[model samples]
Target: MKLLKLVPDHTNIDFVRLRGWAFGLTLLLSVLAVGVTFARGLNLGVDFVGGLMIEERFASPPDLTRVREVVDAQGLGEAQLQTFGDPRVLTIRLPTQDGADEGATNAAVKKVSAALTQAFPGATFTRYSTVSGKVSNELIRNGVLAVVLAILGIGLFAIFRFEWQFGVSTIVAIVHDLLMTLGFFALTQFDFDLNIVAAVLTIIGYSINDKIVIDDRIRENMRRYRKMDMREIINLSVNETLPRTVMTSVTILLALFALLFLGGHVLRGFTAAMILGIVVGTYSSIYVSSSLLISLGLRAEPGEKKPARVDLSNAERIAPRER
Candidate 1:
């Protein structure tokens, strides 16, 4: 009758010692992700680049070329027809001119819709979404601001609750997780839509929460084990919290996996992002957050430091001893 041990209470893995390799690899991949982002850029979805999105369900798998034929006949301009999860569903995307007015774009979309209806009488549109060029630009700006402000907000909260080093380390690890997620998207050319932006923000929040959990444990250990080496203290705290981390991450991953498989293509990107965020977030909480302590000169004790006092009263009261 032995209980299962996810992480033994006395676990003594030298997590701090492996920081260099972990940090280096994460940094390398993050840098590469940025490089790729700048080079090829994200596969901008309609929300960011301005286009028409139509999700249609058919009696059966409609002919892709026939669908394209209808869109081209209507002169929708650069229409792409892709199959959604099952062959019974289709997603048609049409990119508009750079400065086309919204009404004009909508007219073109309507024409395509009409043509599609006539071409495949059995096809039915389940969703119709539109984004203007101006709106898309604004969305891009706002999305970036949201992510930055979220990080800044978390950093400020960490600073008020913990040391400045903890705040900085938390932000760094969060940025690492963000970069890794973005890198995965960039490399895979996944559709970077408003939904995905939401996912990234969610990831940031999730990642920071994980880091805070570990940081809380570290802060407690800093006071509890004041005489131990800082590295050892970090190792001890992480090991102590390892079980919680594993349990939380595994639970989150289970839900995300369920969504990834059962939620269909509509939620694929967002679910995949959550999946990636959890793993990187957990790693950063353990390695990146603790490693920064050494780099930022926060390895000292966490207790309050007393200011030096001159005791000027000793000179005035000089008769008691050899003074």
Candidate 2:
């Protein structure tokens, strides 16, 4: 049986020629992402915003309006109700008071549970969680710090591993990926929690991994084809690795899609973020990172300081030959 080929051999795509348009679109999207994130803000979950969350299941899909009214009437803080994986399931959230003790928190949970059960017969309280404002604040700080540090650290590594051009391009692409992910959450009103933070970090890791592969190829080509134009070298490098890139991305997307559909609603947000990240990461790696190298003054020649290697394969041995 003949194996299928995703990308043909000797493929020569002019990725650099379209850099102008790619850069323009990248800028537009990045700006919109940042703007949307600021304008709408993230819908933080109990993990980030310090709140009480109760997961309840009903024998049948209860009226959401009535459910909200009951929770609101309890005089708990503003109630945020959202359907979980199933229509018959719901997650209700209410902001917790600062410095609320364990007793007070449990009492609040009991109050909501009691009211919800009384108002809707056969309502089952599956679980509940509480986060103090102080703890949530710390989590937010740590999450932001972790993401920023990861990006910066990766950029520095790229710089050291290859060149300054590689590092800068990597950073730009990663920032774009993160902003796009955040923007998506802001627009969709998806719950932003530690899970999404993990997704973002994973996206960064995947993006850098893909970028490093392409960068290594580009650098190799630059050294081997010293006289080739930078544009040609970039095109050659990306095309050479196109098959690996496509295969990896396609395989990952397949698994992610499966998890997206089969995974419970609890994982839906994380899976969705991951799916978007893979697509965006691939695009940025091919179009943004590789193409930006040329604009960053990365050339096949000039400023190359490595010592030339001398081949002695055909040279006579200085040592005496065996008689």
Candidate 3:
């Protein structure tokens, strides 16, 4: 039986030739992502912002405006209500209580539950959580630090393992992926919580893994084809690795898509981020990272003085002197 092949054998494509266009599009998207993030801001969850979050479900979809009014009538604090998953399900958040004491928090929850039940019969409280200002601040700081450290570490690894060019290109690609994810969250107002933080770190890992494979192949090709042009070497290397890259990406995407649709709303944001990362990572590995090597002045054989070729057939063989 013939095996399935996503990319055919002996495939040759000029991936390096389109680096200019890829770089342009990447820059435009990164800029737009940054601008959108600063302008619209991310919808942070209680993990980052100190608050009391309560999940409640009604027998039927209730008007959010009316529900907000009912919660506000209790005068607990400012209530923010958003649909969680189903229309009938909603997550209500309120500002941290004055003292943030357990009694006050529980009392507040009871009051809101009573008010909601009276306002909308059959409305049931699912769960509630609280985060203090200090803890939330710490969480935000740690999340940022984790992502930054991961990027720096991965860049350094690339530099040591391959070349400085690889490191720089890897960093650039990762930053692009991160900004794009943030922009998506900012635009969609998805809950940017700790789970999303984990996803971002995971993306960095996957991007680096993909990049390292192609970088290794490129380095190997550079050594084997010392006299070859840099662009030709890059194209050859990427084409050679295209099958593995495509196969790996496709399989991972299959799992992520399953999680996205069947894993419920809790994993929606995380799954979405992973899917985008896979696509963007694969793209950068092909177009941005590999091609950028040539532009970074990486020659087929850097700093290597071409050795003189000796004619062995015409030269007399020297015999060993008798000991």
Candidate 4:
């Protein structure tokens, strides 16, 4: 039986030739992401905005129209409602009340629960939780800090293992992936919650791994082919590794798409992040990483040492013949 190959080995595609175009595209996308994030801002979830969560199991799935009416009567702006694990179980995320006082949050919950009881007396509370403004703010701060630390940690590790240029290139590619992920959420007005942050961090890991694999191959090739030009070596390395990259990305995309389509609302944002991450991550690995490597003036790695510069004064001078 013949084995199938996504990209046959020894294919001589010139990935380096597209570096300029890729760099421009990445720059444009990054700029747009930053702009959107600042101007429109992320639709931060209750985890970062303080809200009440109520999960109740009804004797049967109550009339959603009636339930919506009852909740809206409380004037809580708009609450997010969806079925939990089972259809009989409903999960409701309440909007943050203007007042942060215990009384305000408590009263809001009381009003909501009372309405539920009147509408469906058999309804039983499965879970009730509250997130305060202070706690929410803290969570936001920590979430952001976590991303920054992750990036820094990954960068430092790459630099130590490979070279400074390789490390910097990886970092840049990861950042591009991150900004694109965030931009998608911002553009779609998706809930930017703890789950989404988790997904983004996961993407960082996935993207960096792909980039490192290619970078490692490049380094190895540098050692193997001492006379090869930088562009030629990069092109060779990427082409050689293309099969693995495609296989890994395709596998991940399949899983993520499954989660996106089959998983319920709870996993929607998380899955969306993963899907976008996989795509952007793969793109960065193929283009951004290598491009950044070249742009950083890394014609060679530290391990690929060259001959030391000759001392002109100590070097022998040749006599001119038959002037």
- Output the number of the lDDT-best candidate: 2
lDDT of each: 0.79, 0.87, 0.86, 0.80
Which candidate wins on TM-score?
3
Error of 1 at 191 (Å): 1.9
Per-residue lDDT over 1-323 for candidate 1, one digit per residue giving the tens place of the 0 to 100 score: 99876655445677888988988988898899899888878878889988788788888889898888878777668787776457888888887644566777667766766777787887776776778788999999999999999999999999999989999998899898888888888877767899998998988888887788778877876675565567766776677677778888898999999999999878988888889999989888888887788778776454645334323222213211110
| TM-score list, all predictions | 0.83, 0.89, 0.90, 0.78
Error of 1 at 218 (Å): 1.1
Clashing pairs in 4: none
TM-score of 3: 0.90
Cα displacement (Å) at residue 317, model 3: 37
lDDT of 4 by residue, 1-323 (tens): 99987765446666788989999999999999999988888887778988877777789878887888888887987877766345777767886677766788778777788889888988876666677788999999999999999999999999999889988988899999999988888888767888898998999999888988888888876776565567766876777677788999998889888887798656877988898898999999998898678778777544564555322221112211111
Q: Model 3 segments beyond 4 Å from truth?
A: 303-323
Q: On residues 151-197, what C-alpha lDDT tens digit does candidate 2 reach at each position?
A: 99999999999999999999999999999999999988888999999
* Best-to-worst lDDT order: 2, 3, 4, 1
Candidate 1 deviant stretches above 4 angstroms? 1-5, 58-66, 81-88, 96-110, 117-122, 302-323
lDDT of 2 at 169: 97
| Location of the lowest summed lDDT over 10 successive residues in candidate 2 | 314-323
Number of residue pairs clashing in candidate 2, backbone atoms closer than 3 angstroms, sequence gap of 3 or more or interchain: 0
